[model samples]
Target: MSPRPPRRLPLGTATSIGAAVLAFTAITVAGLGSFGAFSGLTSARLAMLAAPEAVEVEATLARVGITAETLAAAGCSSGDATNVGADALAHLDTTNWNALVSADGDVRDAQAEVDRLGKLVRAGQADQEDLTAYATAKSTLATETSTRDGLLDALYDAAVADLTSGETTLLETMHGNSDRPVPLQYTVSDRTDAQWTSLRNALANIKTSGMCGEDPDTACTTLVTNCNAETEVATAASNLDSNLAGVTSALHTALGQE
Candidate 1:
């Protein structure tokens, strides 16, 4: 069997900084929680196909649950005050279990959303690269048309000026032609260009919004999971591995791997 062309990977989401201007903005990225916006013939199959992403989401959700528990226990009360300073420790309690639930819901929803997006991709609804290319092509076409038109208009004006001039140069005879080339032989269809740009831009916007299907959910969950696991495992194993030497040292070291 011949080798097939390597498939292109999905474009990852851009990191949107929560800046002064975009503080209230919700920045979602495709592959958020990595569930990949569930869409396909079978939800199970879609999930299976995207299992890597799902595992990622699962790990994240579990971690988020842990963090919520941690914060709640640590007594970080929540409110607008969390935005304050050293005193913000009180806000830790503010994160409701519902917040964790909501995060879970987002992670779960990503599977469905990504599947939907995938189906759309298959059906040719909104392709990111296609939209990008379309926009580029439209821009190029517009610029080229304008430049070509300008050149042609200059050609026209120059042709007229040269032909009408008193200079004895019969430029037409040099090319062995009887008449001059037609100047201003160009076309500019505003409707066509506008339509193309509008379509491309619409697709670009769709592509941009759909980009963050489950990535955020996945990221939050993963951070919680890994950090919590690290904390717990370290706390537990450290007690077990006390004063390692010859025979026990290797076993203790292997336990550290866990």
Candidate 2:
């Protein structure tokens, strides 16, 4: 005779069977005389499972603010871009850069809430409400991170533009010359000779280093140093002109030609 087909339990019957198994487990624990120990072990196991996730979440939240701050600092320091010139500085909005400060504070608060919820979960005292709150805080942190990243992108672009314009202006001033003829008698003094040499050396260094070409931030710094050198060159040139004019005037006065 063929065996009768095996019967499948109905939903209600299945639920009863599950309950019986749980009850048997409880009975076995009670017989062991250490049910409390078993419960503690189960809670500890749950906490161990949840701890790593909580730590990872906290680390992610921390990075959101740190990355924003680092980008903002890089943008602001790109080359004294704010003070170089009105047209150049106008390209950037320095005020909005402070947004990271508030965003970081909000992220820290969210992370603290997550930690509290994580503790409750570890202790086996958390309800659905605690988990739900943790999820909400995570969502808030994500939003803050997105906002911060967007602001940083805009600020970085503006800073680069400002630095580029400033670099162009510095280069023009260094290379361009006056069209008027200078007197042959207006020779440079020993001090002027040294100043001219220094300026030439500064320009040479800038050319070899490729200032404002490859890395704008580094180029901006080189430009500042060169600007000071250029000033010295201008002063020396002006002194030579003045000395020449004095000599011409003295010759004309002696000849009674004036």
Candidate 3:
């Protein structure tokens, strides 16, 4: 047989092949476009997923900042004498207290920045720059918050220690002079029943008074009042001891024993 002409595709076959190749090209382009869109969507979803954590962190920092500030302020009031007295030994001042102030301001500023970035992230508008800035601010706020808390605790502890020592000293002084007799202008039996009853009631009230709770301002006020009362009690006891010593001295002189 004569050399067979190269087997050729039919016209229909050629047309069909061309159409199949075009369809494949279109499908591939469409698939690539879909994949790009899916990738963008996934990135956006990841950012949204991270936003709640940012919000929570910011809130926690804010709470800690407020608590530290409140405690520090409570520990150092200008109006409360006990707070002032305790802080005198602790030497707490605006300089030390201002550490919390600075930290609080920093944390608030950082929280605001994080909130802004978190909103952008949730809206799929955040870029890498926003994410980086948010992370940096969060880290800085954490460090500052920790430092602020430490300072607050230290100052509070110092104040407590000073106040406790002062209270103890007053108690010891009162106890030491408890046996001393109060000087009387007349015989005990000559005193009015009402006067004795009032004295007993005053002592009972002082003994039964309760310390303030929860409210820092109230606590400070209570502490001051109690401390003053304790001081007065101690002073009264000391005066009774002095008076008894004077009486003993006068009696010894009268008897010519000295």
User: How good is model 3 by TM-score?
Assistant: 0.31
Whichever of 1 and 2 has more TM-score, that candidate is 2
Clashes of each: 37, 0, 0
C-alpha RMSD between model 3 and the true structure: 35.2
Ranked candidates, highest lDDT first: 3, 2, 1
> Number of the top candidate by TM-score?
3
Off by over 4 Å in 1: 1-95, 123-238, 242-258
Q: What lDDT score goes with residue 104 in model 3?
A: 45
lDDT of each: 0.29, 0.39, 0.40
Weakest ten-residue segment in model 1 by summed lDDT:
182-191
Per-residue lDDT tens digits for candidate 3, residues 1-258, read: 111111122344335433543454455455656566545443222222221221222222222221112222222122222342334223344455345445545656766877888898889898999888878877876776566556545543443343344333332232222223322211112224554454445434444554433333444455435533554444444444444344334323322334
Compare candidates 1 and 2 on lDDT and give the better one: 2
lDDT of 1 by residue, 91-117 (tens): 212232223223323434544555555
User: If both were scored by lDDT, which would come out higher, candidate 1 or candidate 3?
Assistant: 3
What is the TM-score (0 to 1) of candidate 1? 0.18
Question: How does model 2 fare in lDDT?
Answer: 0.39
